[model samples]
Target: MDDNLIFAVIGAGNTGQAMAGYLKLKGFAVRLYDRSEWRFKSLRKHSMRLSDEIVSSQKIDLLTTNLNEAVHGANFIIVSTSTTAHIEIAKRLSEILTNDQTILLHPGRTGGALIFKKILRENRPDLKITIGEFESSIFTTRVSATGSTVHYYGIKNGVHFSTLPAVDVRKIFQILKIYFLKLRPIRMCSTLL
Candidate 1:
């Protein structure tokens, strides 16, 4: 794994927190952001903890309430926010993201990738976008917060990803494999859903 890889997870809810925790355990520098001040404050009180299987004391960098600060320069941006905010967030990111950056959507459902593609095409078509699925939310095993400690129950395997043009599948696979050792790439036939 590349120690230089930086991951920013937006949403800081269960899924976001879990991703940040797991990546941190894997030795990646992770930043977490959420719109909820309450959750942010809660996390602040108790730093996140990874499952027992992995050993690490790395704390996640919290970028609460500031979307741009969380995402602007990240090599990999994982959107774990609710589906309702997906389009709006993607639209905003289209203006700031560069072609080399990747956006991975967790638990993508009902045309989520299509929606992002639509907004990006209409706005910054030149920018590159990649979408993926992480089986389900990363914290599925078990997660509970008390004071400043967020505890996790388990971690799973295999994250699937695909690039917008499909031709860049290899590149996407290469980047994702660094953070997720078990990533599987699937090629899509069309850009439209």
Candidate 2:
């Protein structure tokens, strides 16, 4: 796992779309996926409408409805769906994820990482995976009025994250810093102080 470039932006909503565009612009190979392939059709139409040309899916590596195909060989898997879908996605990912791959539950509001851990463990107890989470998504973006674009409202002032058990906090911080300008490191104890 390179852990530096290839990324899986699961759930191709506004955040996922924006992440796909932004990360691609930053030179990372990005794969976009949703349970429904129709979700990507709108992105193509919107890109064509805004650019007034053929929207080449080639701009990104692959966009598919297949979870296995989307997440294959990905170093970093960022789940961008609503929290309500966590368990289902967890179950799906458990069948595919490799231990070398790290799964980040962006905006892991309450027990998101653990929820995923439990579900994943149920499927494969022998698999040990690294997990990370941020209190919120690093990006603040939305779909345009015409639905042809993702309007990025700039990154938040500060984005802090933690890796469970704290062994790889530094590495997680290092990786996130490349994509998030406002990336901040937080001490788990400091959160309680």
What lDDT does each candidate get?
A: 0.71, 0.74
List pairs with backbone clashes in candidate 2.
46-148
Each candidate's TM vs. the true structure?
Answer: 0.84, 0.85
lDDT of model number 2: 0.74
Prediction 1 TM-score vs. true: 0.84
Please state the error at residue 54 of candidate 1 in Å. Answer: 4.5
Q: Estimate, for each residue in 1-193, the C-alpha lDDT of model 1 and write its tens digit.
A: 4578888898777777777878877777788877777776656665665555554455676556787888877888888888899888888888778777777787664567777878888999677666554445545534454424445655556555565666777877776676666667777667354
Question: Residue 172 in model 1: shift from native, Å?
Answer: 1.9
Residue runs of model 2 more than 4 Å from their true location after superposition: 1-4, 45-58, 187-193
Tell me the tens digit of each residue's lDDT in model 2 across 20-55.
777776678889888886777766543412121212
